[model samples]
Target: MTGLRPAPARVVLRGRTVVPGVVTGEVLVSPETISGWGGIDPATGTITEARHPLAGVCFTGRILVFPGAKGSSGWSGFFQTTRLLGTAPIGMVFAVTTTKVALGAVVTRVPALADLDDDPVAVLRTGDRIRLDATAGVVELLARTEEEP
Candidate 1:
């Protein structure tokens, strides 16, 4: 799973879903370290003062793959505000689970897949196009080429 290969079949993972948007950009993978409050901007979907290495980057309509939630409980609210502001990820992929992220998922109602055995952050590149099926609990990687619109 580390090396490049043809697009694989949709992988399944059972977890909560968050946000409602179309995953149309390259996959941004982050394993284990994600701060809810600062990781994203509700008004812009851009990564705010999250302190993460990828801070200030935007995730609007992209598939945000991570291990789990981090930082304050206010994380959920941030995502809620982003949804209200029309700036939210199309879906989410988590390697682990947490109460805070779960609540956010329930509120956003976006496609989500969690508890993934394979590290999406490690396997998915920043520009890999992806499709998430929350209802079926599957994530399909399309080829990696140019950045998505």
Candidate 2:
């Protein structure tokens, strides 16, 4: 939906809305959990967790799909910084929700949904475009995409 790309076949997912909103963005899936305080660059939206699989990748403006949060309570703070820096994800789909993830989502003010019928990470692949209607608790995956290498 970003450009002239045609809408592809979609799979509608059901979940519980955390922060209600509608957003369409390229999906960025991560099996690895994020460490908050020292894991990310708020200014650039890049994953900086050392030795992590997604290190150096930028999740900016993407639909960040992951399991849940890790590390300390600093999780919310770092993500909040991302919002202040304008580098937060457009939306998030979590397989499971924690207080940390919920707080972070609200502070970042992004459309977020959790506790899905199926794990979003398993259903969503990186590079798949998703239109998330968090208010309605739906995730629409659009077509196969070139998986990031």
Candidate 3:
């Protein structure tokens, strides 16, 4: 017997550009907001906030998908440290846009988009592959996470 593979699911989303760049990476969805000042460890690129869903999770290299930023104005500085430490996320997608997140995106110097047509936190799942084009304000879902049979 022969079997055929199904085509990969693809979804395109439009959003406001927060940064101008393009990058493709696995999605890391954080339903809640993230704190940059004391919520993350810049050196390790890991979330250090206790009780958070993604506590102890490292966002390095992945495309971080979340609502928005929280905590102090030092948010941008913490993310900047990640960039300096070479542990920053390859891309970022935000559901909400604020001055703090905008500044962080600018300093992180990564492809980032915000205010999408749909809530990315609801649409994207961890492990899904996506291509982010912040310059064009588009997010293309390249592939979905495979389900165990």
**Candidate that scores best on TM-score:** 3
lDDT of 2 by residue, 1-149 (tens): 32324445557899999999999878889988888888888999999988888999999999999999998899999999999998999999998789999999999999999999888888887888778999999998765565433
* TM-score of decoy 1: 0.78
Runs of candidate 3 exceeding 4 Å displacement: 1-8, 147-149
lDDT for residue 144 in candidate 2, whole number 0-100? 53
lDDT of 2: 0.87
For all predicted structures, in order, the TM-scores are 0.78, 0.91, 0.92
Query: What is the descending TM-score order?
Result: 3, 2, 1
Q: Give the alpha carbon lDDT tens digit for every residue of 1-149 in model 1.
A: 13344555554333334433344445777644677775676777887664576787787777788777888998788887878888877778777678888887766667777766567776676767776766655566776534332
Q: After superposition, how far is residue 84 of candidate 1 from its true place, in Å?
A: 0.3
Candidate 3 worst ten-residue window by lDDT: 1-10
RMSD of 2: 2.5
Q: How close is candidate 2 to the true structure, as a TM-score?
A: 0.91
TM-score of 3: 0.92
When sorted by lDDT, best at the front, the candidate numbers are: 3, 2, 1
Model 1: ten consecutive residues of lowest lDDT: 12-21
How well does model 3 score by local distance difference test?
0.90
